[model samples]
Target: MASYELNAFDRRFQSISLVGAIEQVSPYTLNVGYWLRDPNQLILYPDLVASHPRLDFLWEKTCFEIFIGVQGEDYYREINLSPSQAWQAYQFEEYRYPETMPPQVAYDIELNQLKRTHYGLNVSLDLTEFMLAHKLKWSDLFIGLTAVLETSQAQQFYAMQHSGQNADFHNKRDWLHIF
Candidate 1:
């Protein structure tokens, strides 16, 4: 028989070696991983009973829990749950990849549009792919164009809206120079 230790609170699990040879499943023999107390009744995990939507169907359809004990042993235990609940007790927070900034040169809409329409047809067609496909070196033309456009647009908007009449620079010479 195999032995295992499971810590519920900290969510630690350890598997201990079994004493007997691990029985192989065959047409005539059953290989059960857990032992059950009763032959007629099924034992279920409480969390599984509450959380799983198809628990009843699985319990009814499958011989999930194993019956194991000494020949004369009265004590028995059973493990019952839907396939989803089988690993619920050891659930851990999912790991998320860290955020990365896209290349500065990738922001050019013109190049992006050209690449999308004429070459790759999507954002997935990056410079790397383009280089691989066409044997071209790296290019930042799009990013530079985008930065220039943004700066010019900001300057034009600021000039149009603000007449440079703020109180911080009331002196005519200072105001004229600032404007």
Candidate 2:
């Protein structure tokens, strides 16, 4: 398991701390965890649901995101997991182009836990099948973990590293973890 401290692009939420962790449980399962150390409950979260649904535009609120990309390719996959038990996944040809439809293979959230301060989500995507379809291996994939925290006043972007002048989570250059 690899853990990273996500830095906030906006400096206002200094009282809160966000940390994201990723681990490959098996050949087909991927687990991601997020902890928000908000003593004052500064972040606003949507109500949790018993059943998680695949929804779009999860980034508008408090959402956790993961970007998976092949080491030398422009194509990548993005997963968005929300505290509200809403999630979304997308496959991009390059940058933000061709987001007209969902991924050919749907990424499913197997287990999800939403607590007062910690949110744990386990997602399963067939690695063997993905490699066969994409013509890549585990070593060829890199990851980017990020989040959007919505506070009472505004929304803040968080990531392992922000390479550009703006908080662009889509930027592959900021993705540093190897799958």
Candidate 3:
């Protein structure tokens, strides 16, 4: 398992930190977890967080995202995993452009809320299925992790690195280096 800690784009949300990890369970499977850490005990204020079994537009609220691709290639996939157990997957031919390739795959998502302070989201994807669907095999992988957080008082974006002043998580620069 490889872990990642993220800093918010803005400084006002300093009390919260986004922690996540990627686990290679098998050649065909990958497990991912995103944890929201709030040590300030600020759970009761701006109570806009939630979890539900939704299908789309999860990025509009507090959500975790994963962008993955084969090294030295433009092809990639964007995965959205929400705290509510909702998932969305999209393929891209290169950069931010969408690719109408293999159909989106739906997987069961697990949600664990620990002590009303930490939010844990877990989801495993069939990496082999995706690789075959995208014609990517036996290649080193590159990945990017990010999150969008919305509370009663504010909405914030966090990523491995800030890409621009506008706070876009999709930027390849915002993604962490290949692991």
- Comparing candidate 1 with candidate 3, which one achieves the higher lDDT? 3
Residue-wise C-alpha lDDT for candidate 1, range 92-175, written one tens digit per residue: 111111212211111111111111111101111122332333343222111100000011112101010123344111111211
| Rank order (by TM-score, best first) | 2, 3, 1
State the local distance difference test value for candidate 3.
0.66
Q: What is candidate 3's lDDT per residue for 14-132, written digit by digit as tens?
A: 87778878776655677777777767543222223445343667677777788886777776777877665566777666766653344344342222221122465677776666666
- Candidate 2 wrong stretches, greater than 4 Å: 99-128
The deviation in Å at residue 128 for candidate 1 is 55
Best by lDDT: 2
Report lDDT (CA) for all predictions. Answer: 0.19, 0.75, 0.66
| Runs off by more than 4 Å, candidate 1 | 1-58, 87-179
TM-score of 3: 0.76
Best by TM-score: 2
Show the colliding residue pairs in model 2: none
Give per-residue lDDT, candidate 3, residue 76.
70
Task: Say what the RMSD of model 3 is.
Answer: 5.0
Better of 2 and 3 by TM-score: 2
Scored by lDDT, model 2 comes in at 0.75
What is the per-residue lDDT of model 2 for residues 1-179, given as tens digits with 9 covering 90 to 100? 99999998876668778888878766656667777787877788878766667778788888888888888788788888888877777778789777564443345323333333354444444355556677776788888999888987688899999889999998998988996
